[model samples]
Target: MNSEARNQHVGKVTHHELKQTLGTWQLWGIAVGLVISGEYFGWSYGWASAGTLGFVITAVFIAAMYTTFIFSFTELTTSIPHAGGPFAYARHAFGPTGGYLAGAATLVEFVFAPPAIALAIGAYLHVQFPGLEPKHAAMGAYLVFMALNIVGVQIAAAFELCVTLLAIFELLVFMGVVSPGFQWTNFTKGGWSGADTFSMGSFHGMFAAIPFAIWFFLAIEGVAMAAEEAKNPKRSIPIAYVTGILTLVVLAIGVMVFAGAAGDWTKLSNINDPLPQAMKFIVGEHSGWMHMLVWLGLFGLVASFHGIILGYSRQIFALARAGFLPEWLAKVHPRFKTPHRAILAGGVVGIAAIYSDELIQFGGQTLTANIVTMSVFGAIVMYIISMLALFKLRRSDPNMERPFRAPLFPFFPAFALVAAVICLATMAYFNFLVAIVFAIFLALGYVYFLLTRHQRETAPTDALLEE
Candidate 1:
């Protein structure tokens, strides 16, 4: 047997085998990038589009929901210490088909976000060299990161650690310079007049913001993919999930409120790049430091791409082993033990998406919107099925071993399921047409699953059953 297969338990994984592979510090680096996704999504939502107070409120709600969901997933991960993170968990709980769908949805999350990140990277590179070509920059960013991932997990983890640390430091530096200028008066003064009818002060205004808030808080599970590589995952996974979300929430609220209060909200509407604009306006001409902050923050785009590639390569590897994707995509490099083929395949898709976006006219109603909304659709669907798996496994496989058990059993599982359903309802309300598009993707995945089943390989035991 291979070393990995031998290291795993005879019948089930035990706590003893859960030793660290890369290093605790490197693992921590990956978690930091995962947690800071809140900041990335915050920029995408744009303070100008959502207003300051409203954005802070959304951040708070998302943090709480995210914390709860990840904590529950940690329980699932520890219970079944397998290579496939969510895909394995789903199979253990539900069945083969559910596992297939969960894996497919997550693959979409990892595969599709590359273009957006690449485009953002291009935008930053454009700033330093105004005449630089965007497509070439985007393609280069994608290719370099793909090559980095192909090298090995340890190398990718180190790169992620460095960029994540720089990104955090830059954010802190910019916040420090602009923090003193915060004026509480800006929040209430000249708020919501004429064409913009949303009021920050009214209860009705807060209620209307939930849909936007849901969009802002998506993608917290981006960290769950690290389960296999983590040391003492049972303990570490829960802590990282909670800690990461809390850190982002506090920082996001602080930056949004302080920046808004320090300057004028109307000024936000006029700025194309909100972070640098807010920093410059608050810090005045002393704002040369803000330019440095922009470059560092831009490095975050690179860091995020690295984390996503590492995370998704594992997902692709897991699905391939389970007979969903082609066998070739499942191959691990002999020296690196990383999914080299999957990484290259993912790079191709990411590069293509980047080119496609550049060639097409992207607006509010376009593939960008479709891809982003579909990620939410994937998350919600994955959440519901996984939750059900939690409850079902507890009953059907009561004798199965579990290292970490979710608190309150059926209740927490039920809570996660209901909360996800509510978020889906919110998505439907805000954009039914977008909901329809997401539904189409899920249907297509299911159809693909149906066509591939007849040709799938069977374990020796399954063949015995047929005989």
Candidate 2:
């Protein structure tokens, strides 16, 4: 087949539609549910790089960045509500090249995140059941949640709400259970990695800790991807985005402070099951409270695992519907009204990532850190592009209807852009291998686009419901 013929045939392909059934609360559920697992694990790695006080400093800075970014991002989402999320914003601002990069970065961010979360889920299960291999358990989790998402968005979102609520309740219960053991001295001890005062090494550690601190609220922006499925995105997107960030900020700070105060803090620094481990300091290793935490805490991981799968699938569908990826992936199940092909495609990549990490060793480093760093690399790229899109749109399309304008305007987005650049540079320096791998993936995506550019140009773009 000639290139022009292939392009014409691709243009003739039909696109399936996503159903709109989500309301404000459901949107909040998905946003919070997507990131709630950060409370359960991942953040502890910050302490491994920086001490307690150092990690706290990093956390505060990251929290500020997210606060500013979320506000600015909400404006773009409401103004151009689409499942493409960052891709749509960049497309409107910069054209196909920019759109392709933004979409690829988002795909990297959402696609890589689940494998890391899946490992944590396996760790939680392993803590409860000694016989369960973490890898096997992680694969099982991928199968179950991907199936749940494939069933339907409403059912998936409803499940997310229930599990997110349970996860929040468990966090509260953990604080109450461990409050008696909390001591100020424990948190402050070894605060600067045993140094009497801060030094250049401490400063570097703070920078290196950015990705782990990011884990606390990494995929919160994913809420914007649900805009197409949202009943009234203009109103509900802003409400859900704002409320969800506030909720996560509170949980992130609460878990960090309380978990540190409850024990040596160093012990849980790099562990997969930080919450249950910290609880052990208060209620002995075999205590009933600890057991309850181990079992219930699994819900936190499940919530995020399930919610993020929903996020990545929508992103995949959006990209395919717009011809950035294969159009067949944009197809929805007639009965379920879900993007089953996209959901399954993302699941295959996630599950493969898990096995690849286990079976293949890289630079003598653990799989979890590499995967997490790769995801952070994608996130930082997305942040930079998305923030730039906000600025470009304001100047390029002043008359655009913005139901929710970012309060500080240019300052907020500028701050986020700078912060994202710093974080990206820091991660590249500290995790050169993962950064290289991410760059390679991105380059390959561009190459693929170049080879298939004709098809995208000829393809019908109106099929996607970009509001």
Best candidate according to lDDT: 2
Give candidate 1 regions above 4 Å deviation: 1-20, 35-37, 40-50, 190-218, 269-272, 358-367, 408-413, 459-467
Cα lDDT, all candidates: 0.64, 0.88
Shift of residue 402 alpha carbon in model 2, Å:
0.6
Q: What is candidate 1's lDDT per residue for 346-447, written digit by digit as tens?
A: 888877766665433333545455555555666677777777777787888787666677776666666677777776676676657767766676788788
**TM-score, every prediction:** 0.84, 0.95
For each candidate, C-alpha RMSD in Å?
Answer: 5.3, 2.8
What TM-score does candidate 1 reach?
A: 0.84
* lDDT assessment of candidate 2: 0.88
Q: How many clashes (backbone atoms < 3 Å, residues ≥3 apart in a chain or on different chains) does model 2 have?
A: 0
lDDT tens readout by residue for model 2, 351-434: 898989554347567887778778888889999999999999899889889999998878999999999999998988888877
Residue pairs of candidate 1 with colliding backbone atoms: 183-261
Error of 2 at 428 (Å): 0.4
